[model samples]
Target: MSYKTILVHLDTSVRAHPRLETALQLAKRFDAYLIGLYAVFEPNARAFNVMAGSAGYYEVQAAMRRERAGALERLFHAELTRAGVSGEWLAPGEPADRAVPHHARCADLVVAGQDDPGDPESYIGESFREHLIMSAGRPVLLMPYTGFFATVGQVPMIAWDGGREAARAVHDALPLLKAAGRASIVTVDTKADDAGPRIASADIAACIARHGVEVEMVSSVSDAQASAGDMLLSRASDLGADLVVMGGYGHTRLRELVLGGATRTFLESMTVPVLMSH
Candidate 1:
């Protein structure tokens, strides 16, 4: 029911500090063990040397990665000390797309950054977030690439559709929901077929209320042009929600991951932190 082990992904990008700050806040709040995992893409020395035809190219890259890792390790420890939290630092030299998910499986929650197209240093490949969500088997709290979130889980908005994924996400976020004291559950463009006949937002609201979280239900009818994801973001903005809880819907097709429309929208343009479980 509570997060005892929280793993955070750190890298050389400018957003790493903010991501770590969010993680630290959660660790302190939940009295959880914090893990600062330094995982990033390091070029394959042998392959890159063959392509570049320069023997020293790989060495230069390796040295730079090491330097950045050292700096980040120091920052992680200092922040943990300032926060008075117990944690450990890990730098497993491997591609982050693979390493992060591997380490995240052991934690109750995973804190990571949304992929930044503007920052090539932070790019681990296409569909990195999708891969993590689908493979982590745990809730992942993703921070936007461009924002400073001083607090999270204070005012949360839940995107509900009554599907299995949504149900999983709601329960996975129970800890934060209870801590927030209140939350808004928004259902956009709902159809009987989508959420079944008997289940309603009010029903889910009551369930959450039983857990001591005051809940409000908002049913919105999206315009023909506006997608469900757009409506969810708009509602989050109107409610001043600091965190959003929703399911990450995606499926593998032809060995490539294709995210659902709503999930894709949030990943690309989230105004607040999102806690997603698949």
Candidate 2:
């Protein structure tokens, strides 16, 4: 039930170090294999060359990309050695949105940083986080860009919706739940059919109890003016939760990975580490 392999996305952005350090700490905690993945996109000048053909421009651009890749590779190895953690590095000549998800398929969990909306060059695009969570077929642990997380899974909040995606997230988070000291399972905006949610919450609590986790069930009715995500976050803050476990996008159609309301809210205003699956 433990994560045996962890894959982390790396880039040349300002927040990359925090993301990598967080991954390193998790790897050490779980004693798992850590893999650092970087994607470098080489600019294509074919469209420009359609009117003005120049092979030299493409060559120079390719050289610059290669140089940047080398620098990033060196940094990765240096950090890996200094940390003394078991890991490997992969730098593929593809877009991050593609390469990261490709490698993420085989990992037990993927670690990524929250996209900084203010930094246009923030290694990964803001939307790519949702894309990876939806496409990777694995659980993703996202670190907040504005905060530092030295450890995780001590106190967790589970956002329960009773959908397939939410169920998947709960199951995927079993390893962390099994090790957590305390946890809370909360449902937001439940239907008038309270019996079903009560039964479901009790069942989930029982399941986690078997894993040796102290679990509590919480039910909150959302205000008409506030979104479900906002309520969940507020509750999590009240509980002083360090980790959030929830589904990625259960209510809305992905349509090329466009996020739903709750999912988008988590991406935009996450204060703690989030573990999401779809």
Candidate 3:
């Protein structure tokens, strides 16, 4: 159940050292190949490069880009050479949101930061995780802010939804769930929907049962006190959960997750690791 091909999709903004270190450790333990992915969104690039045209500017910018890629590869190679660290450099040309999931397609797992520390709020507002979970056909391991952590998938929580996203997350996270000692299916009740949770919970339980992993079902009210995302996280924290697995709700342009206020809050402030799928 150990992951062999691990892809850590990241932004140029994140300091590469810590993420590289974490990936190296995992690679050493699992003898896995780490794919370090960096995507340049066309819109973001255009917005960033707006200025009077100058040869020096283009040259310097191009150098910086190459340097970032080289630095990431060199750093990973150096650390991994001490053990079994086989990794490759991935620079996807599509928009960041699109490229990440494409990288995830061939990967057993995709990793990313939960929040961009520089912005602090809004969870990157990019739907990056959402895109991967919904379309990657794989599992995504979302590292919480400030990246340094021990092994993930230790104590996990499954966010139950009857949709394809939740199903894929559970399937992809099989390695984690099988390794976990304590895990549960946490769902919240929406004002207008009562049957969705029950159906989702049953489906998730059945899915896990197929893998011989028993998951407890924890249901809460997505109420006025907090959004659905916040409530589930709080419940997980109360249960001393270390990781959460949930189906992402979102599309490309219009963020589908906004409909669920809870997901937004959880994405922004979740302290523990979250394995999200769309």
Best by lDDT: 1
lDDT of 2 by residue, 115-227 (tens): 78775446465368888888899999988888777678888999987766778888888888877756899875545453253336677778778888898888763788888
Please write out the lDDT profile of model 3 over residues 211-237, one tens digit for every residue: 778778777445786667777877877
Clashes of each: 0, 0, 5
What does the lDDT come to for candidate 1? 0.88
lDDT of 1 by residue, 76-121 (tens): 9999999999999988767778898999999999999998989877
Q: Model 1, residue 28: displacement in angstroms?
A: 0.7
Candidate 1 wrongly placed segments (more than 4 Å)? 52-55, 190-198
Per-candidate TM equals 0.94, 0.86, 0.78
For candidate 1, the per-residue lDDT at 104 reads: 96
Worst 10 residues of 1 by lDDT: 190-199
